[model samples]
Target chain A: MKDLDGLDLPTFEDVIAAHARIAPHIRRTPVLVSEALNALTGAELFFKCENFQEAGAFKVRGACNAVFGLDDEQAKLGVATHSSGNHALSLSYAAGRRGIPCTVVMPRTAPQAKKDAVIGYGGRIVECEPSTSSREATFARVQEETGAEFVHPYNDPRVIAGQGTCSRELAEQVEGLDAVIAPIGGGGMISGCCLTLSTIAPHIKIYAAEPEQADDAYRSFKAGHIIADDAPDTIADGLKVPLKDRTWHFVSNHVTDILTCSEQEIIDAMKLTFKRLRVVMEPSCAPPLAAILKNPEVFRGKRVGVIITGGNVDLDRLPWIKG
Target chain B: MKDLDGLDLPTFEDVIAAHARIAPHIRRTPVLVSEALNALTGAELFFKCENFQEAGAFKVRGACNAVFGLDDEQAKLGVATHSSGNHALSLSYAAGRRGIPCTVVMPRTAPQAKKDAVIGYGGRIVECEPSTSSREATFARVQEETGAEFVHPYNDPRVIAGQGTCSRELAEQVEGLDAVIAPIGGGGMISGCCLTLSTIAPHIKIYAAEPEQADDAYRSFKAGHIIADDAPDTIADGLKVPLKDRTWHFVSNHVTDILTCSEQEIIDAMKLTFKRLRVVMEPSCAPPLAAILKNPEVFRGKRVGVIITGGNVDLDRLPWIKG
Candidate 1:
């Protein structure tokens, strides 16, 4: 909880501080439980529904932390990020809360609903090619032009500390959770979970759920090094990013294991969650449930926490309703 | 809050009894609030989400009350009901919990999903031709053969009192609501709201929302008499039946107004609820929201309670997705 290299990397103390700083700007989303889902999966599941969060995702936690933690002069200059999904909307929402300009670079192929949400939250979108190089190039140009503070989606200490607040709330909301599972995208949420659970409830296991199609996190953990993917295609669009050093520190140390699920499994689990929990969430959020369903032995007969990461999908183009 | 007409007709006292009797069987569903929704409509709204209730609707409260309220001799023969929706599912669920026999008579034209749910909950289903005369004849024969106690979907005092528990919880959860809106079908929920709110908080306006395509409740409220509709088609399939004597007693005496919304407005409101609330409520539950959106002048800047009725929907057959 002490100085972790002058806060360049967040410690448990930093996450606790993030909770205090971002508490006013973000929502204290409720934890939901479903008997039908518990019966179906054979696990006592507690869902931390970040889909009900301000920007419709857990990304808001970190974004709010980063935006609000900035010095007044730095915050006035604004914030910039590159995200094709919930992070863009969340950063925009956080920036809007502080009454500052937000610049977001998103892939042109990103869903129109996500783009609309970012714009609705008062973000200026800088469209980039779907490739990572184009996105970074555009992001760099925007940051330079706006002179905005650069806040990486998952690599920054403030954002990781911010996401840590979710698990802190979950640990307090549900007693005796045997394990906690969160879908790993750029490893922000899982790292945050590791950051908090390691410091507080060290006995609890942390699992990172990933899409099989975009399984860089799984591969990286197995290989014992960072394995970057350029453009991994999956129904879970939010999880295509590779892990960086800040996120890797926690994933490599605190996480018990990284689990993976197939594209069909993700879609089916998502449909089931929608049916039983009656909560509308995107495909990216479904991997944790899919992992539990696929490996019931891992989660059976235990109190487990499942984080529903986001709920910003175009209803007109649900994966199951094939055109 | 005393007894009226012996123990046969439910008084406000019956609602209090129902709340205690059914407490062991039903869920004390959560009250949700969405800032985005409030910002859009300018109404400080509190949603009593019965969509998350056991058997996926508030009918479970009534069904549980009816099943549990029966005496030793009456419960021996078990219960019977004729419903094409949530009531049938609810009765079966309650019966399943008590380990008793339950018989449900349904029109052959009812959705396969509803029939499956009834059977899944251990109820015997007898399908009849999709006509009022045929349904009545079939239901009579089933009850005669099975010797089951008839629990009418919305007409019976037991069911009305059971539904009253919802507003009771809402009153305890959120304070000083200017109005409460519920979608009306056979006037059961609205009547329950009337029964509870009139006694507990007489200053709060009670509004009944009805689909314009099946506006019998709206017409009957204006005419100051019960106007029975045998069959009326609407997307809110649950709100098609006519008001009966027990429900009419409360609806006529206590309800402030009956509001109607067009089919298109209902669908649009449903989509909005799915997007903003992140809960998968059926079309029948969308009328309160639709009415609020259409009549913001009446609800603007006021604290309003919106009851979300049910979540038993077929995802494959979403209205926005054309075949």
Candidate 2:
């Protein structure tokens, strides 16, 4: 399925194939419910705990699909990506499982914990300046040297198809969900949800949540086209990226709405989830919950599914705690 | 069953009955596994996440059993306990569900987060000095004034029976576990494991893990009798209480060994678990994993079920971070 821009869009078939290809590698993460959260939101919320997923994020699903789907010759060439977050670790985890070489182009200023995680998964890190031009230049040189395939953090079709498997599992695990909301960064996760739900259950509304500090997706939704941002800042570090053409296709065509919440709201929601759901998740996973809490009128009396995107937090610098 | 110490010990049959009684009130928490942790320790570790329980701890199982088992006349009196930990909030959670009043006599210096949780769950708190004598004295006055039944934190057979249900579920969830380990704070959770595993899966050995700073349980195990500690201190606050007679009966008979770890080891294990397992657990839950890492010979090449006792820590004061 190719879009008007000639870029291929993933279909329901691709999602199904992704599920089968990655089933052996990825965990069918559990969906948990908290009565306390339900009471607070005035809506029953089912949390898809991808924080418990292999490599501690839903990104592993796509990473595994991409790595394992490679031809024998392509496998020998290895895989590469530019990410200073969960994707870097997740791709490393997937590549290691397949016994292939993995290279990550990470910003020199990325947290030591994240760098350690990628290396712990048998990944080699190449330092890059903390800028898009520097990252792309470094990544291109590394790819030329190693002949490694580039897997965009969220812009690739294989990754979107892989992410779609999460919603499929959620639909099977739960019945009669009225709406599903997920935090949108490059829109890989939310786009995946949009792809799967639009095909199998169009009645189920799909909503995207974003941090107010990085509201490019929300503005793009309002304007009905792609809107790219430059160096947006948010405590949700993973959500600072702008959506590319592939993800924007799903966001513009299928998503019902895009909601945004403030930095303080994101931190509060993250802490409430820690306190009530008793789960450890990152700030990127909080915006959907924050939006749900902030706009109760839209969610009241409905059964909502909230995707907890990842749990790669730096415990020493927890947002709510002072140094 | 009555022991020579003139105290009644809970049987496996009691565990079965307690399971049926509290099934509706508690969560059948998921058992999680981390390949990274397994590789690190050279053991197949299955973590039963009781931190995700209804009141954020396994204590809720016993609290529900005790609160719901009261006769009509006793029900009118409600329930009371003396503690500044999960027990206070758990009993309150169960009592609130049953529409009964719950009172807790807690040390004035207990963390504000814990006190807030108890009050949030509809449990009334009475402040006392941070000493056993003061706690007992305050508890007696509250019991006298309210006529509420005194539910000993871990000494009661009913409470022990409720705790046993956790292992029964573990035994059903995972097959052929060579051993089981849990932190022994007054031996409530360990006693419960002993009661259930000793009957249904006698081939499996039960081990108790304790912090060296509060090693009364470990010392008592070696001394061949109960050795009450006088105000021992540790980062693992939940394990500071000395084992009472009822818990000692189960620990002395069914436990294979008692393992102890340093305070630093507990902190390290807690942080490691938070990073690897992506779960928020209290310091109390880390001792078992710490002991497993410290004494790898006992657990290596064995299937081990580790009980993550609870996840009720104050996020603002995480042990690893400097204030």
Candidate 3:
């Protein structure tokens, strides 16, 4: 299997540059220290609350960086992408800020709240069946018809660099972090974390927390090969993506471990978040929390950082709690 | 009705002193800025997220201050209070930290979650009927039986000084705020807000937001007399307190305006808070937001500071959205 050596890995300097560019456009989301969570796991926990970021997700950092970094001509041509939810809303918001057009190819089964958010931000939506093949086909058709530049949610170099800015800020926000854990979907967030952490704090361990049902990244990392889910099913809608070649390379090279957590554990952690932290997080955003709770032996006594990547949960579809 | 004269009025210096003393015990809750809210209301809004504070509300600040400020004899007897919800949990949490026994007189109608939280924190409960007469009589009986020092929820000087810590932090967090707004319940929050603003930024205007259905403070401000609700009815369970003499005096002297918002407006603002800000705010916490939304012209083009006071909403009884 080919490694990430030939890929254009974002340098720490590049992430720093991206941070500066997006600083004016995005929020420096708060880093919260949870005493209750720390007491529960016996570890000092630093929660990077990207759930409070603009558009209610860290995807805004990447989306804003990608849209704002474009050349005048490319930006004028506008951008399009396919996403489950967070990335689409983020792209729409960023594009709206720049007065540029944004079109999103979303799954027909995507939450109505998310669909409304996309349209609310002036993004044209192209709905397709809930399958990778259909999403790719739909995105291709829309891109070809509209002559819009493709902004692959996690595959593009610019998007990866853009995502790396989150880790750059995290590394600066807290000190003495023994490890940083983030949920892996298509590996965009983990890849960005790896690139930034390796360059600045190379000794810090980087782990990926994946849902047990969608453990392709975990299997791929362990077997020294890229793996795809045969038929994925998880309540963590944001983490449904199968890894791409570029992201897989980065994960293969830099991520220290990939941890898997159960759906019940995810729900339990989401409830803890709502009860203690007062932030509503989707299932995917709870994986790192589940990992820390279930396997405290690994994270205990260490300064651990967890990224609460998004809080765009549909109130009507909240999996664990009933209204 | 006598006003808070120069001798009795709390100065910014007093709040600063109280803040310094209580800083170690209280959570320095973060200030979150919402671009989505800003665009919606055309005002730059700064949210002081006391919902994320320890004990799940700003009440802890006052509770801790009141509990810990007691002299050795007073501390030995422990403390007691009557509350609908947040204050009971806060007082319990504070008393627990001091290794002292605490009792809470609560209406039988208080939410189960709040009752559980009070017990979970080790506070003994003395349940009474929903009316003020019954609550006061029950509290008197409990106080006489146990010899526990009664800590009034809002009327006490120490509690008011403790609540002032929130605005002191806010004054430091956001510069040049044209005005500050907080939900008025027992008038503790607004009284403390007035004290802090009058002391630190005398030029900054202060507004009290109240539910129209339970507009005791609004009526009092308008009629130049204390107005107790003849039939208090609102979904904002936390803000149903009739004005106490001390709080009413402070508010009349320092508060610039007391505005009333309809129950529907409060419910709608709560929904927006859950959807956009991802914070689960109870209806009382939504009053300031309701004020901002209902009278956008008053706040438009201004830097407005809003205190999101608590997040003790029972998901099962969420009033705004139909299940």
For residues A207-287, what per-residue lDDT tens digits would candidate 3 score against the true structure? 999999999999989889988977789989789788987788789989989999999988888878776778877788999
Candidates' TM-scores?
A: 0.97, 0.97, 0.93
Write one digit per residue (lDDT tens) for candidate 1, span B1-323.
33456535677898999999999888888888888899989999999999999999999999999999889888989999988899999999999998899999999888888898899899999999988799999999998998999999988888889999999999999999999999998888888899889989999999989999999988998999989876789999999889887788888888888889999999999989988989999999999999999998989999999999999988997877775
State the TM-score for model 3.
Answer: 0.93
Q: Each prediction's Cα lDDT score?
A: 0.91, 0.93, 0.85
**Clashing residue pairs, candidate 3?**
none
Candidate 1 residue runs with Cα over 4 Å from true position: A1-7, B1-8
- In candidate 3, how many Å is residue B316 off? 3.3
Q: Which regions of candidate 2 fall more than 4 Å away from where they truly are?
A: A1-5, B1-5
What are the per-model DockQ values?
0.78, 0.78, 0.52
Show model 3 residue runs off by greater than 4 Å: A1-6, A107-112, A127-134, A145-147, B1-9, B107-112, B127-134, B145-147, B321-323
How good is the docking of model 3, by CAPRI class? medium
What docking grade does candidate 2 earn? medium
What lDDT tens digits, residue by residue, belong to model 3 across residues B25-88?
Answer: 8899888887779999999999999998888899999898888878878898889999867889
TM-score of chain B of 1: 0.97
